[model samples]
Target: MKHINREVGSLLTRIIEKREKFLRAGDHKDDLLGLLLKSNLNEVEVNKNSDGGMSMADVIEECKLFYFAGQETTANLLTWTMIVLSMHNEWQERAREEVLQVFGNNKPDYDDLNRF
Candidate 1:
């Protein structure tokens, strides 16, 4: 578990560093990391006399929380979906047919997902 935590921290640090480079170059994105960095910069600017903004570690921790939360939500969604499908054969068949019709023996495309 300690090794895993170190690995995750290292990865998040690398990601944050790369985003910081882009941010410094004026290539600001509206994504989560970008927004966090922007907010941190704003806070620092506002509180030039004190340490009032999130540190790199704090940003990484926030990212970790969001990452885990998203995974949990996705897992719960899939679990519930499977349970519902198992209980409703007709709905499951319809869903299967729709998927097959939309993507038969091929990888699904993002544009075609709206058809479902």
Candidate 2:
């Protein structure tokens, strides 16, 4: 388990570094990863002045937790939603129409989700 954790941690560290670089070069987008990157920068500044801030490891751990937990939950929800939609085609069509109406071809933002 310890070895597995170390492997995962190493992978996550590389991922975070790459993401930081992408964030620096890419256009701004409001999303969870973007928000976390902002938080990580703030935490770094805070840690420079005091010891009461999150470390890089802590931020990495949080990113890992969010990735795993959020991915699992979203996957489960999508699986169940697909199952339910399959069982009820009428509702599925309705949902598809609603999504198209709300978001068209673009991804839904927070306001769109709330309205949906």
Candidate 3:
């Protein structure tokens, strides 16, 4: 939680500053970070120092959600996969061999992951 708090806080701070520069110049785009980036990105449209944008408290809570949700989903998947593999080494090795045959120990591509 601490690590998530620090990382998200820093990222959000930088994003907010960048958003300010854009807004001041009347720039707009569909960048995901365009609105969500700034702490006051939306608020600044009418009120420069308004607190109408996502609040620090909300951002902090969101960071907790991201960390918990992301970690739990991925960790559960990996743990279950590893358990299944350990219970069936032969099947696991066959799958591994097929993977090596296709990718040959190199990094995978988006296409390959999509297929998997």
Residue pair clashes in candidate 1: none
lDDT of each residue in 7-107, candidate 3, tens digit only? 87788667656665886698865554454544355565667555556665565566557667989999999999999999999989998999999889789
C-alpha TM-score for every candidate: 0.88, 0.56, 0.52
- Over all chains combined, what TM-score does candidate 3 have? 0.52
**Runs off by more than 4 Å, candidate 3:** 1-8, 19-53, 105-116
lDDT of 2 at 114: 85
Highest TM-score against the true fold, candidate: 1
Candidate 2 ranges beyond 4 A from true positions = 18-31, 92-116
For candidate 1, give the lDDT of residue 57: 91
Q: Using alpha carbons, what is the TM-score of model 1? A: 0.88
lDDT of 2 by residue, 32-94 (tens): 766788666667677776675566698778878888899999999999999999999899999
Please write out the lDDT profile of model 1 over residues 1-101, one tens digit for every residue: 99999999999999999998888888999988899998898898899999989988999899999999999999999999999999999999999998888
Provide backbone clash counts, one per model.
0, 0, 0
How does residue 4 of candidate 3 score in lDDT?
A: 72
Question: Is 1 or 2 the stronger prediction by lDDT?
Answer: 1
Model 1 accuracy (lDDT, Cα): 0.92
Error of 1 at 107 (Å): 4.3
